[model samples]
Target: MKITLEKVHGSMNTFYMVDGEERDDYANLALQLCAKDQGVDGLLVILPSNSAHAKMRVFNRDGSEASMCGNGLRCVARYVCEKEGVDEAVIETMKADLAVRREETLMDGIETYSVQISPVSFQLKDLPMEYDNQTTLIQQAIPEISEEIMFSAVAVPNPHLIGIVPEEIQKSPEHQKKWAEKFNGQNNYFSDGVNVSYVTKVGQGIFVRTYERGVGFTNACGTAMTASALISCMSDMVPFGEVAVYNPGGMVKCTVNKSGDTFELLLTGNATRLSVHEFQWEEEQVDSEFTAFEILDEQRQYEKFIEEISVVVEQFAKRKE
Candidate 1:
């Protein structure tokens, strides 16, 4: 059947958003569409919702259904708001129906949207990580990961492990991958796998690099960044308010509103639509010619936005050095 798949990204964490009827073959569909050849970080299916403006179902490249995806949620926000002729809407996720709103352009010609990242938890039973009798891990050193670095686990609806590491460990992608593999693989530490992020406090903001569950390492992970920001707040590394979260892909702003033990985060970033593909999709395969009319302007504008942030990134790296 002929269908429209919009390629979208928030902070360069990409996904192919399909506004279609809800179906059961999402696992198989994600595995196929998210393959490396014609792939994205994940697949987003937008279905009509009785409880909210729209429903977002996210499937990672590994065909795992995630509880929430803030990046994907922003894309869905833009798509649904544009379709529904509204500036704000509540989109149903696997965990909750999140509030998303259209915002002023974040940069030159780059459309922006802000979505809520919420219902934070640090309880052990909430995460896939298997830790001892502790109810939560808040900046504790887990010897299995690294004796020196402290880790904090949070379920911002999707399980995440955040570590504020020193220069050496933060710069070491191999170091992050090494431990991420152990926990995501055959290890008792994380029986069901976890999204692991290594963060470094930078001169301008905080830098985060995430090794995601199901998707391995991504250019960015919105929920992971939000979790990391909340961790930064919990650790007093950064104040609990508007925090600039930078990843390898790009940067996003996370406003962490803290009231006692409760936390609410607003994630704002570029919801750039790369292109609209005119293609035919079958039940099992891409059965016909798929023409990609690339959006050069959005790509160019986003590149400029990336160029604008390179200074802060450079300053961060230099300060680390």
Candidate 2:
């Protein structure tokens, strides 16, 4: 396992990318390094590109495969920008065109990298929730759950719910576990599956903690942020426009709008680099190093690039204000 590693920083978070199938094993080492230094916030393992196809899978330090990751994108973007010496770059994923840009960090000793997420769309049919075409008001309470949470399924590529809980509910271990269980199960709202997000507001910004489907509880989820923000706007919790989302891990800003018959979302967050290490493995006669590729046309990539840049400009403008 000849593995290469890169250190990239986003916001205040640092991540390590292991270019080999032994990502989980490497990620554990990275986590230990972060613990030793006491600065690393998250760990992501990007699987090596396959021979026949180029694709990557992500895993958090806890050895969980996240359905979607926003912060990790910035770390990868930094790798491309610094290694390739290009301010603007595109990372092809299995799902969407991740248009990335190098940005100045607001906080000292931190680097800011931004990546635009796939546009958001809400279709119960598309999400494949339990609800049918006619069911509009889903006020059903999940069985064996006490939070009285309501769920709305949205896809930025994963199923998620915008669980609205009262502010008075103290965030105890009991409370967190209670909601997490309900979100993971196939309740009356979503039979196929669902990721549960518990939301609250701190000042003008909205904060969330996600119980992801593929992965358990996590500090932040980019897709969940977009879905929760959209649900907030639709429920009039927050006005339509750009929304500031605070997750347990950190903050990610989301923008949403209506397009034709669906809602679109743009999720922005920071990423960072952790460490680089070589895998202790022998060389292959036919292989050089682990590689991955994504198939995206130039036109689509350029369009996404422009859109993401525009969002970065918006963030800069907000700073000016």
Candidate 3:
């Protein structure tokens, strides 16, 4: 059977969107297609929602499922909007029904989408973290990683551990990779594993690098960035406003708000449509071969956008020095 798919990315965290089909082995399909060297980061299966506009299911590269993915949500929103020829849409995720809107274009041909990342919670049960009687994990010391490495855990329905590292440590790619490896897995402190973000404060923005739970060392993790922004605001490091979150992939803006015990998060970034392809699927195989794959040639436009942002980042880094 021929299946249509779209390769999309938000803040460089890519996923393949496929129409929902009656398949019992979607996990295996996600594993085959989400390989870094072959496919993308994960798969988003579009489903029909009776109460909402559309429904989406998120699957990570390792055949594990996620409750929500902020980056993936943006791409799905764009997909739904374009397909329906609408300016806005509501996407029902596993965690919550999110509202997304088409914002001003980030670049020529590159559209920006903002998604509401909501119902924030810090309760251990929410993150389902085993932290020994702790209701919240905020800058707590975990001797496993380092007594010095303080982390804050939060769940926007997707669990994340945020670390505010020194600028020197953040600058070293090797350090970031090693730390991510140490804290993620069956034998790690987080038994269920968690998305880890190491962040550093820049002038008015923050630089973040993430090691996702199922997908490790991605160019960016949208929820991780939102978690970092929330932690920054909690620590009074950043004002309650749009926090510029710069990842290795590109930059996304997160607006955070706190009112007493309630918190709200909004993520604004590029929801890029990279390519479209049609593939053939067999019932017995784990992987599918594309019968007709076509690149949209938007790579050049995306590259230009990246180059322009790099110049700005370099200037910002230089000023900090």
Candidate 4:
């Protein structure tokens, strides 16, 4: 079987966007294609939807399916909107039907999209975290993670454990990988697994480093950044408005909103197309050698935008490279 896929990214969190018309073994495909050689974080499958413009299913490199992925949704939003010749779209995710639209211009020559991340919750039952039988964690010390640093748990429909760390911890990447390894493994914290992020405020903006649940340390995690921004607002780390959330990958704009008891957020960032590939698939195996490839030019523009805005974060991101 022949397969055509578009390589894309949001905040440099890359993915392979494929239509769900061909083979059905997405789990295997993600496991194989998201390897180091393929150089993608996950796979995004666009399936037919009756309730919205399209449906998005995310498969991590570890063959785990997430409830929702903010970055992948942005990429999917742009892809479907452009394919259907529309300016806006309502995409059905695992948890909610999200509204996404093209941004007029976020950066020069970059395609930006804004998407709704909703059904936010702070209850422990939602994240299902087990810690001393606590119901909610709000700027409280979690000794398991750090004896001094405090954490706040939030689920943007996908579980996240965020902590506002000090400058010392923020500069040390090894510390994050250490704790991420502990929580992602069989300890006693997140049983099912959770995305862990250590964030710090930097001149009205915040820099976030994430250890994603199934993807391990990543350049960015869309839901994690959204959760981090919301936690920052609730914890008074940053004002409740448009926050410049910087990650190792790039930066994104987040706005937190609340009405009555409900909370939702808007995540805006670049959805740059990287390249196109033609591959052969048979018996759940994706050919490593592509017959033909078309590398796109949007990445240079995206890198330029990142270079201009990410002086502080870029230094840290370079360590990942």
Per-prediction TM-score, please? Answer: 0.94, 0.67, 0.92, 0.95
Sorted on lDDT, highest at the top, how do the candidates line up? 4, 1, 3, 2
Candidate 1 vs candidate 4: the TM-score winner is: 4
Using TM-score as the yardstick, the better of models 1 and 3 is 1
Best by TM-score: 4
Displacement of residue 267 (Cα, Å) in model 4 is 0.2
lDDT of 2: 0.56
125-153, model 4: which lDDT tens digit per residue? 89878888889888898776678888888
Candidate 1 local lDDT, 1-321, one digit each (tens)? 667788888877888888889778877767767663344888999998899999999999889999899888998999999998999999999888899998888786988999999778888788856778688898999986688888999999999999899877776689898989888889877778999999999864699989889988887899999999989988889998999998877889999887777788999988888888755666655554465555535878888888888876554332110
- Ten residues in sequence with the least summed lDDT for candidate 1: 312-321
CA lDDT of each prediction against the hidden true structure: 0.84, 0.56, 0.80, 0.86
Q: Model 3 scores what on Cα lDDT?
A: 0.80
Model 1 clashing residue pairs (backbone): none
Candidate 2, residues 39-142: lDDT per residue as tens digits?
Answer: 44345554434331223455544444544566666666666677668887766564666677776653433455666667454666555565545333233444
Candidate 3: residue 165 Cα off by (Å): 0.4
The TM-score that candidate 2 achieves is 0.67
Which sections of candidate 4 miss by over 4 Å?
22-24, 36-38, 284-289, 319-321
Which residue pairs in candidate 4 have backbone atoms (N, alpha carbon, C) closer than 3 angstroms, thus clashing? Answer: none
* Of 3 and 4, the candidate ranking higher by TM-score: 4
Which sequence of candidate numbers ranks them by TM-score, best first?
4, 1, 3, 2
Stretches of candidate 3 off by over 4 Å are: 35-39, 311-321
**Ten-residue stretch with the least lDDT total in model 3:** 312-321
> What TM-score, to 2 decimals, does candidate 1 have?
0.94
